[model samples]
Target: MTAATAPTGLGEAHTVYLDHLADADEYAATDLAIGLLDAGVPAERVLLDLVAPAQAEVGERWARNEWSVAQEHAATHISEQVVAAVSAHARPDPTNGRVVVACMDGEWHALPPRLVAEVLRLRGWQVTFLGASVPAAHLVSYLHRYDADAVALACALPMRLPYAHQMIEACRRSDVPVVVGGRGFGADGRWARRLGVAWAPDAPSAAELIADERALRRVPPGQLAHLADDEYASLVRRRSELIDGALAELRERVPAARAYTAAQLDATVSDLGHIVDFLAAAVYVDDASMFTEFVQWLVEILGSRGVPVGAIALPLEHFGAVLRDFPRAARALALGRAALPGVAR
Candidate 1:
């Protein structure tokens, strides 16, 4: 199939796999994936075309409130199983140097990177699939110990870009060329460019990049001179204070919040913290759209779960007022507020 087209039967296969995910039927999901392999569908195609897109839909289902967190987790677990089954069914011996694949610190979305690792393996690279949230120091130590030819880092959330940058630099200090991918880098890998690392849009491109040492190491220097303004650093230092203050403001402004159940209150606190964290990351990257996009996503997620847009608006207004002295942060908050629905604005 060409780059723009899905294999003839794959679309139907994706639908069936998603149905299996929705049912939380691990055996059925695994059987379906392996059966595709048995039918002569390439293993990489099963992973990238079938399991990957199904997992993306699982996330969308949760975002739309059609699936609970429990359901999403169940589906994700099943997808992981299917990936493992596909990998085992088509195991290929490594014919190239070792590549260490891992998630950035604080990033728990390991499945995307796992697919990449398996793809690298299928293409004949020895891959050490270090699962989710591998810390920078530990990752650096492992790179040194194993003398990795290259490392592929994954970050599924844009909010973790700061940690991703740090981890990328740590690997560089050990003389390992780094290639990063995932939604965290933005769909175009713009954030990865901001950090001055090689970026792959998917597993196939990542495998190709890893094969060409010169291309992988030839990225331009990071364009983080704007960090000299110190807004990102200051925002991070005040993260806890910002979250607490936002929660206090929320409780005072929204009377019902004071009587929220423990679970509801925890969720509120988490959302507040995410706002500050996402804002900090945006500031770090000097991109207001990052914060704005996150606000839009947060609104959809919360709105689907019965939250009013005002619930999100109030926090944006609060953070804007509090960070008024920090130009970059204040500007980003303003853009985020503008991105809210008309009623909230």
Candidate 2:
């Protein structure tokens, strides 16, 4: 491959990027990463949104067992391709120094670091995207070898927490500023803080966090807590619309008065479960289980009210952003409710 010729214009670039992402399930995401580079979207933006976000989404699905190992492997292989292509695009620039990104040992999720590398590189920083599962000693060695402006690590699971702490400790010993992030961190950001490291909730935020190292370094610990609070609040606000809408819909449907046979009860219970699942999903992302639990309890309460319909239905329905969004929640609801018997329907 002499390199797919770079897409000629912005419109052409849009076409190529979308086309690459279209049957993305069919090709390794790495191919799409190359396609983005070839389309000239800047190595950084592609890494931030397209490459890293795609990989994170895949990892999330895998955690939920929604994606098989093969699918995850395919995605990772494509990510390697993208990283290679982006590296080829890198050239020494007088403008900015280097930033190094790596995954802590026990942290096999390389895509986050890769995406962060691309983001820094795109912003004119030199970047070295070390692949997954790097040990603290190795990272410390690299940090000194490269004289990195900042060191970033992706810690995506609770199991990786010890390793992450070690890596951050290594950087701190060397007096190097470190940044950590991943969905695994979730809303409990205090751990990152307690570890005495800066935390980026997502790729874009990471880029911003590192854009001016001295300023970030200058901030006192007390000030940093304020920033963390703001970040968490923003995430809640971002999802508030969906959560509120779902609760509204759940308030509408009333349970029926007539008693039903076992078969009817089973079907009705299943349907109600579906409705709960659907509504739960509408309010949360990648959190179908929690949503299902909350909705099912709501359903049981509504069913006992002597109401003609499950009161939770209409309130949850109001959350309908689209029909497809409801399936995961519905599936979750069905699975949960299926276990219970003698619950008021």
Worst lDDT run of 10 residues, candidate 2, spans 222-231
Q: Alpha-carbon error at 305 in model 2, in Å?
A: 35
lDDT of 1 by residue, 254-285 (tens): 89999999999998899898999899999999
TM-score of each: 0.96, 0.53
**Top TM-score: which candidate number?**
1
Report lDDT per candidate.
0.91, 0.57
Per-candidate count of clashing residue pairs (backbone under 3 Å) = 0, 22
Off by over 4 Å in 1: 1-8
**Prediction 2 TM-score vs. true:** 0.53
Poorly placed runs, candidate 2 (over 4 Å): 1-42, 60-66, 86-94, 218-345
* lDDT for predicted candidate 1 compared with the true structure: 0.91
Task: Give the local distance difference test score of model 2.
Answer: 0.57
lDDT of candidate 2 over 175-278, digit per residue (tens): 78887887544455545654556788776677787786875465334222233324223323434454444443443332341345677555545545444333
